[model samples]
Target: MPHFTTTDGTELYYTDQGEGQPVLLSHGWPLSSDAWQVEVKLLADNGYRAIAHDRRGHGRSAKTYTGNDMDTYAKDLAELVKHLDLTNLVVIGHSTGGGEVVRYAAQHGVGRVAKVITVGAVPPQMVKTDSNPDGLPIEVFDGIRAGVLKDASQFYRDLTEAFFGANRDGSNVSQGAKDDFWRQGMLVNLAAAYDCIKAFSETDFTEDLKSLDVPIFLAHGDDDQIVPIGAAAIRSAELVKDGTLKVYPGAPHGIHGDYQSELGKDILAFISK
Candidate 1:
C-alpha cells in the first residue's frame, strides 16, 4: 500500500487512481479510507483522479499516542496534498473528515484545493457553547469516550446501526456493511481512538468555514442519528459564503450507502460545475 510520512513522522496510507482534476477524499472519525471506496471508484471512472487517505491511528496509518487532534490531522493532510503536487483539487470530507478539510484550508490557506464538499460533516462546531445552543452537549461526547474506553469493540458493534441508521427494520444497508464498519473501527489503535473523541467533538470549525473563498457543497441526511442534520449540515450550510446545502429527506447518516446513486449523480454534477 502507498503511504506518506506526516510532519510528526507517522506513516499515513493513501490510494490514488485515474487521472484529471484530482478529487481527494477524507473519511470520518474511527473510519478509514475504505469508507470512500464507492466514491473513489465513481470519480475515477468518470475521468477524475481519486485520492483517499487513512487518518493517523485509523486504517493502515500509524497508531501514535500523540497528535490525534484536529490541528495535527489537518497538518497531516496538508503535507500529503503538497507532497502529491495536486492542484485545483476538489476535496471531499465525510463526517469528522469534513472538519479536517476545512481546518486545513483555513489554517494552511487552502494549499491547492479549489472546491470542497462535506458529507454528513461535523463543522461550525458539534459541541454546544453559549453561542451555539443547538449543538450537541459535551455529555454526549463524554458518553462516547466512556463507551470506547470501556469496551471499544462492543461499542463499535453497537454503534454500527446508530452510526448509519441501519437499525431500521427496512433499512437498505446490508449486514456486511455494518460488519465492515466494525472491522475498521476495531483495527484502529485504542489509545488514538479514545483521544480523537475530544478532537472531533470539541474543535470549532466556524472560523474555518468563514475563511473559505471556494465553493462548498454540504450534503446531509435529515434523519441522521449520529450527527443530526439540523445541528450539523443545516447549520454548516448557513456559515459558508458559497455553500449549497442538499438535504436527503428521511435519509440517515450513511447517505452514501443507501443513496449512492443520487449522491454519485449530484457529486459528478457539482464537480463538473
Candidate 2:
C-alpha cells in the first residue's frame, strides 16, 4: 500500500497513476479516493497524471480521534503534494474536499497550482455565523452528527438518495452507485466521519477564497439537496479572483458520477486551454 507520513506522523494512503500534467482529486465527506475512480480513469485517458488520496482516518489511512479538522486535512494534503514534487497542478475537490482545496491553495499559495475546481463544494463557509447569516443552520449539521452516532450504515444509505437526487420524482436511481457510495463511506473511521461533520460544516473559508490567484472552476448541480447551489458553489465563484461557474440542470450533488463523461470533457478542455 503506497502511503505518506503526515507531519503528525500519521500514515496517509494515496494512489498515483498515469503521466502528464498532475491533477489531484479530493473526495467528499465520509468517503475515500474510491469516489474518484471514474474521473481518475478519464483524466488519465485524456493525458493527465491523476492523483487521489484517502484523507487521514478515511479509507486505508490511520484513524485518529484528534486532528480531524480542516486545517490538519489541508496540511496533510500540502505534505502529499510536496512529497510528490508535483508542479503546474490542477486540483479538483468535491464536497468536503472542495473546502480542503480552497484552504490548501490559500495556505500554500499558487506556487505549484495552476487551477482549481470545486464541485458541489462546501466553501466560503457552510455553517451560519454572525457574518454568514445566510449559511446553513447548525441544526442541519446537528442532525448529521446524530445520524452518524446512532446508525452510520443506514445514514450513509440514506445519504446516497439525498446526494444523488434519487428522492426526486422521475429521477434515475442506480443501485450500483448507491452501493459504491456506501462502500466508500464504510471504509472511513466512524469517529473521523463524526468529527468531520463539524469540520466541514463550521470552518470559515472566506480568507481562503479571497487569496486565490489562479483560475477556479466552480461546477455544481442546480438540484443539489446536500449543498444548495446558490449558497455554496454560486457564491464561491463570485469570491475568487478569476473564477468561473458551471451549473448542471437536474444534476445532483454527485455530479462527478452523474455526469462523468461531460464533466471530464469540460475539465479536459479547460486544462488544454
Candidate 3:
C-alpha cells in the first residue's frame, strides 16, 4: 500500500524491504514489480535492501489512458528514488525496464548509483529505423499492441510461452510459472499495456547509453525471441563506457526468471565486486 506521488500528481506504488545497500528493480512491460519476487528474496537474504515498483498505469498504480512513455516512466522512478533518499544503489532492469534504467541514469544522473544491469533490455532502440537497420520492424510491435488490445488474457498466455522459451523444443516451461506471469499481466491496465508497446519499441536509448558513467552489466539470451540478444543487448554493451556483456545460450527474454539462480549469482558477484 506504500505509494509516492510523481511530479505529474499520479500516485505510484512501490515495495521497500530489508536493510543494506539498496538494489532497485524495474520490471518489463505488462508486468509489475512482482516480477522480482525471486531476486528480491535472494537479495534480502544476502543482506541488501531491495526495492521494486509498479510503473505508472501498471499493477496497483494509477491507470490513465495516457502518459505511458519512457520519459514519464523514468521520471516516475526518479521521484521514488528521491523519496527514499537512497544512495550507492544498484539498479537492475529487465526488458523495457532496462530502457528505463538507461534513461534514468542518463537523464537523472546516477549520483547515488554504483552500478546498473539490463537483462534482455530494449535499448539503443528496438524498432528498425533509417539509422539502425539491425533493429526489429515496427510491425512486430504493432502486432503486440493489436494482440493485447484484442485479447489481453490470451496475449499474456502466449507471451509467457515465448518469454520463457517454452515455445522451443527441449525447453522446460512450468505451468505455474506461466500462470504467475499471466496473473501479473492481468493486474495491469490494458491501456497502459497498449501504449507501452509504442513506448518500449520506439523510444531510442542511444543518447542515454552514451551518457551513462556508471558501470553496467548487460546480459541477454542468444535465443531470445522477444528482444533479440544480438540486436539489443550486444549493441547496448558496445555503447556503455564501462559495460560488460554476458550471453546465455538457449535462454529466452525472461532469462531473469528462467535462469534466476544463475543470473542472481552473476548479479551478486558484480555487486560485491
Candidate 4:
C-alpha cells in the first residue's frame, strides 16, 4: 500500500518488492499495478527489485479529471522513478504502458535504465494519419470512447475477447483472467478512462522510439486483435536503435499474461545480457 504524491498533487500507489537491479512495470489502459502481478513476482523471485504503479485516476490513484494524456502519463512515471531513486532499471510496459516507457525513455535519456521490454505495446502510432497509413482509424478510438461512456462494464467485457485473442480462435486464457481484466477497467475513473482512449490512440511515439538508444524488446502476439503486430510491434521494433521483435503465434494483446513463464525468462535473459 505504499503511495507517493506526484507534482500535480495526485497520490499514486505503487508496490516495490525484493532486492537487486530494479525491474519496473507500467500497466495497460484502464488497468493498474495489479496487472503486473505475475511479472512482479517473477522478477522478484529472479533476484530483482520489481515495482509497479497505478497510473493517475486508475486503481488506488487519485481520480482526477485532468492530465489523462500521454505526456502526463510519462511524467508521472518519471516522478515515480525519481522518487524511488532507482537505478540500473529494466522497465517494461504492456499495451498503452509500452508507449509510456517509450516516452519516458525519450524524455529521460535512458540515464538510469539498462534495457526495456514492451508486451503487446502501442507505439509509433495507433490511430491512422497521413504519415501512419497503416494505423487504425480515429473513428475506432471514438467508438471506444462512445462505448465506454455508454456501458463501461459491457465494453470492458466485450474488449476482453479481443484483448486476450478469444475472438479469433481458442484463447489460451482463463475465465478468471478475463473477469479480472473487466473489473480493472471498471475501477478506472470514468472521465480518465474516456480521455485515455484519445491519449493512447493519438499520441505519436515515432520520434520517441527513434531516440531510444537502449535495447528494446518488443514481445507481441501475432494473433493479437487489439493491437495488431503489423501496425504496432512490427513498426515499433524498426524505430528503436537496438530493438528486437518477438512474436508469439496465436497469442493475444495481453501476451505476457498467458505466456508469463516464457516472457519472464526472455526478459531476464535480455536484461542479464
Candidate 5:
C-alpha cells in the first residue's frame, strides 16, 4: 500500500498505476480510493496513469478524528500532488471527492491540474439556504448524522441501496456493488465519517466553482438519489467557467459502477480533446 504523510501527520494510502498523463481519483464519502477501481484500470489500460487515494480517514488511510472538513481535505490533496510532483494532472472526483477536487484547484491553483472531472459529485452546495433554495434541506443531513450515530453498520448497509439506486424500480445495480459499498463504508472511522457528512453536505463550493478556469467535465446521473442532479451536477456545470456537462439519464449516484463504460469513454475523450 503506497502512502504519504500529510503536513498534519496523517498517513493517507493511495494507488498509482500505468503511465501517461496522470489522472488523480478522489472518491466519495465513507468509501475510499477503491471506489475508483474500475476507472483506474480503464485509464491504465488506455495509456493514462490513474492514481486514487484513500482519504485521510477512509479505506487503508489512518483513521483521524480531526481535520475531516473540506479545507483540510483540499490541503491533504495538495500535499498528495506535491508529494508526487505531478503536473498536467487530470483530477476526477466522485460525490464528496468532487467537493475536494473543486476546492483543491480553487484554493491551490491549477498549476498542476490539466483537467477536472466529477461523477455524481456533490458541489455548488448541497444544503438549502437563502441564496441556494434548490439545495437539500438541513434536516436531510441531520437525518444522516443521526443514522451514523445510532448504528453506523446498519446505516451503511441501508445507504448502499440508495447509493447505487438498488432500491429503484427495474434497477440493474449488482449485489456486488452494494456489498462493496457497504464493505468500504464499514472500514471508515466512525468519527471521520461522521464529520465528513457535514463537509460534503454543508460546505459551499459556489465561490470555488466560480473561480475555476480550467476545463471541467461534470457527469451526473439524472436519477441520482443521494445527490440530486438538479442541485449538484447541473448547477455546478452552470457555475464553472469552462465546463462540459454530461447527464446520464436514468443513471444513479453510483455511475462509476453501473455506467463505467460510457463514463470511461467520456473521460478519455475529454482528456484527448
Candidate 6:
C-alpha cells in the first residue's frame, strides 16, 4: 500500500496510475479512495493519470480524533499534491470531497490546477441558515449523527438505500453496490465519522467557490437524496467565477456508480475541452 505522511505525521493511503494529464480524485464522506475505483479506471485507461487518496479518518488513513474538518482536509490534499509534484491538474471530487476541492483551491491557490469538477457534491452550503433558506435543516444532520452513534452499521445499511436511490420505484441498484457502500462506510473510525457530519454539513464553501480562477464543472443528479441540486450544484455554479452546470435527471447521489458510463463520458469530455 502506497502512503504519504502529512505535516502532522498522519499516513494517508493513495493510488497513482496511468499517464498524461493528471486527474486528482477525492471521495465522499465515510468512503475511502476505493469509492472512486470506476472513475480511476476510466481516467487511467483513457490516458489520464488518476490519483486518489484516502482522507484521514477514512479508509486506510490514520483515524485521529481531531482535524476531521474541511480546512485540515484541504491541507491534506495540498500535501498530497506537493508530494506528487503535479501541475496543470484536473481535480475531481464527489460529495464531501467536492467541498474539499473547493477549499483546497481557495486555501492553497490554483497555480497548478487547470480545471475542477464536482459530482453530487456539497458546496455553497448544505445546512440551512438565514441567508441559505434552500439548505437542509440542522435537524436532518442531527438525525444522522444520532444514527451513527446508536448503530453505525445499521445507519450505513439504511443510508445505502437513499444514497443509491434503491428505494425509488423502478430502481435497479445492484446488491453489490449497496454492500460495497456499507463496507466503505464501516471502514472509517467512529469518532472521525461522527465529526465529519458537522464538517460536511456546517462548513460553508461559499467564499471558497467564489475564489476559484480556474474553470469549474458542477455535475449533480437532480434526484440526489443526499445533496439537493437546487441548494448545492445550482447555487455553486452561480458562485463560481467560471462555472458550467450539468444536471442528470433520475440519477442519485451515487451517480458515479449507477450513472458511471454517462458520468465518465461527461468527465472525459469536460477535461478534453
lDDT of 5 by residue, 1-273 (tens): 799999889999999999999999999989999888888998999999999999988999999999999999999999999999999989999999999999998888478888889889899999999998999999999999999999999998899888878888987877887888889999999999999999999999999999998999999988899999999999998898899999988888886444778888999999999
How many clashes in each candidate? 0, 0, 0, 0, 0, 0
**lDDT (10s digit) by residue, model 6, range 92-204:** 99999999998998778478888999999999899999999999999999999999999999999999889999999988889998899899999999999999999999999
| C-alpha lDDT values of all predictions | 0.87, 0.89, 0.89, 0.88, 0.91, 0.92
User: What TM-score does candidate 5 get on C-alpha atoms?
Assistant: 0.98
Q: What is the TM-score of each candidate against the true structure?
A: 0.97, 0.97, 0.97, 0.97, 0.98, 0.98
Q: Looking at model 3, which ten-residue stretch has the lowest summed lDDT?
A: 253-262
Q: Look at candidate 2 and give me any clashing residue pairs.
A: none
Give RMSD to native, each candidate. 1.1, 1.1, 1.1, 1.2, 1.0, 0.9
The per-residue C-alpha lDDT of model 2 at residue 177 equals: 86
Off by over 4 Å in 4: 256-258
lDDT of 4 by residue, 1-273 (tens): 899999989999999999999988999988988998988888899899999999889999999899999999989999899999988888999999999988987887378877888988989889999999999998999899999999999999999888877776555688888999998888899999999988899999999998888899999888878788899999988778999888887777775454777887888898889
Q: Which ten residues in a row are the worst by lDDT in model 6?
A: 254-263
What is candidate 1's CA lDDT for residue 140? 95
